[model samples]
Target: MSNLSDIIEGFIKELLEANSQRAIEIQRNILAQQFDCSPSQINYVLTTRFGNDKGYMVESRRGGGGYIRILKVSTSIEEELKNFLNESIGDSVTLNKALDLISALRERKIITDREQRIMQSILGDRALKGVVYEDRNKIRADVLKEMILASAENDM
Candidate 1:
């Protein structure tokens, strides 16, 4: 069975899908009531699953009129790639973050399944095991950025 966090993430993704604009405003309390979970649980799912690194931006207003707004940040392949390179990847990225970024690329059909697997293999922790702990993330970021650029070049 899926965990509560997974379930809530799915529900929110469904709502986002139903909206033509690919964005949604939701009430934390109402969603918490519906899920029978605390508002903090909802916040956990939103931050971990829908964060900027995962290609979504979350904004929340706290109060009686407060609401949470989730926005799908990328509109086009170019824009998405740019965001990943210029913003998401940054100077250093953990292996998990790199994998998530690769997953986002695959989700958008920016890369094929085979390509995704290949990229994952290249960026996986095992591949970087020999590197110094402090330098691994930095090297990973540089490599992934180049790979993304190469893929974009091929598409052109």
Candidate 2:
């Protein structure tokens, strides 16, 4: 049998799939009670499995009527890529963020699996080992930005 976290994740994903908007809001206490676990456990599954890298955004309100809002990223590939380039990334991007961007691109079929592996390899920590800690993110961001722009130009 799957663990509680997996079960919870599956349940939430099912909800998202069932909704046309691909978004859902659930009260933490209500969900916890339904799952027979603590609210913190639900939070753990959310943070680890539904992060931007995994292609989901989670927003939570804390209070007596707190609700967790989960949104699956937009499916329009071109618009999504533009948003990422203009807003999600800036002068510097962490390795995880870069990986997330790459993963999203792969998920959307914007980039092939081979391209995904190549981009990941090029932008990974090992590839940046020679750079100073302070400069790694900046270099990664620059490389990613250029790669995306180049890909866009080629597609045109």
Candidate 3:
């Protein structure tokens, strides 16, 4: 058996896979019991492992009869990559937002973990040293656009 968090993640993924729509709903209390963990543990897995960057949408209710719903969005990675180029990112992007884009690509399975790390290394502040803030952001934007385009091309 794997770690508790991994086991819980696997179980939820199994349920999602077994369904036709790639979605699933469950009571947090029930899931916690099944995993022999606290309800918070279940929440931790859901938030960190199944974040938006991970290509999941989560909804939940607070009280009794409340349920947690996980929906796997059907989106094209290339489209999102383009959107970033055309909209989200301006001439420059903040480090945090840049990393978010990378994480989203990884979550979408458009890029591998190695790719994410490589992008971060090449686009991080250190790589833009001596450049003014404005120019650095512009450089970051260009680099990210090129990388995303290359990745999208490879996918096609």
* CA RMSD, predictions in order: 1.6, 3.3, 3.8
Q: Pick the candidate with the highest TM-score.
A: 1
Per-residue error for 77 in candidate 3, Å, reads 3.0
Regions of candidate 2 where Cα sits further than 4 Å from its true position = 1-7, 47-66, 73-75, 152-156
Can you write out model 1's per-residue Cα lDDT over 32-110, one digit (the tens) per residue?
A: 9999999999999998999876778899999999999999876677777787798889999889888988998887778
The count of backbone overlaps in candidate 2 is: 0
Against the unseen true structure, what C-alpha lDDT does each candidate score? 0.89, 0.86, 0.83
Per model, state how many residue pairs clash.
0, 0, 1
Give the lowest summed-lDDT range of ten residues in model 1: 74-83
Model 1 TM-score? 0.90
Candidate 2 per-residue C-alpha lDDT over 50-100 given as tens digits, one digit per residue, 9 for 90 to 100? 877567899999999889999998755566667778776789999998888
- Candidate 1 local accuracy as lDDT? 0.89
Per-residue alpha-carbon lDDT of model 3 for 1-156, expressed as tens digits?
689988998899889889998889899999999888999999999987786656678999989899999998776766666655777566778887789888878866788999899999989989889788778878888888888788778776
Q: Give candidate 1 regions above 4 Å deviation.
A: none
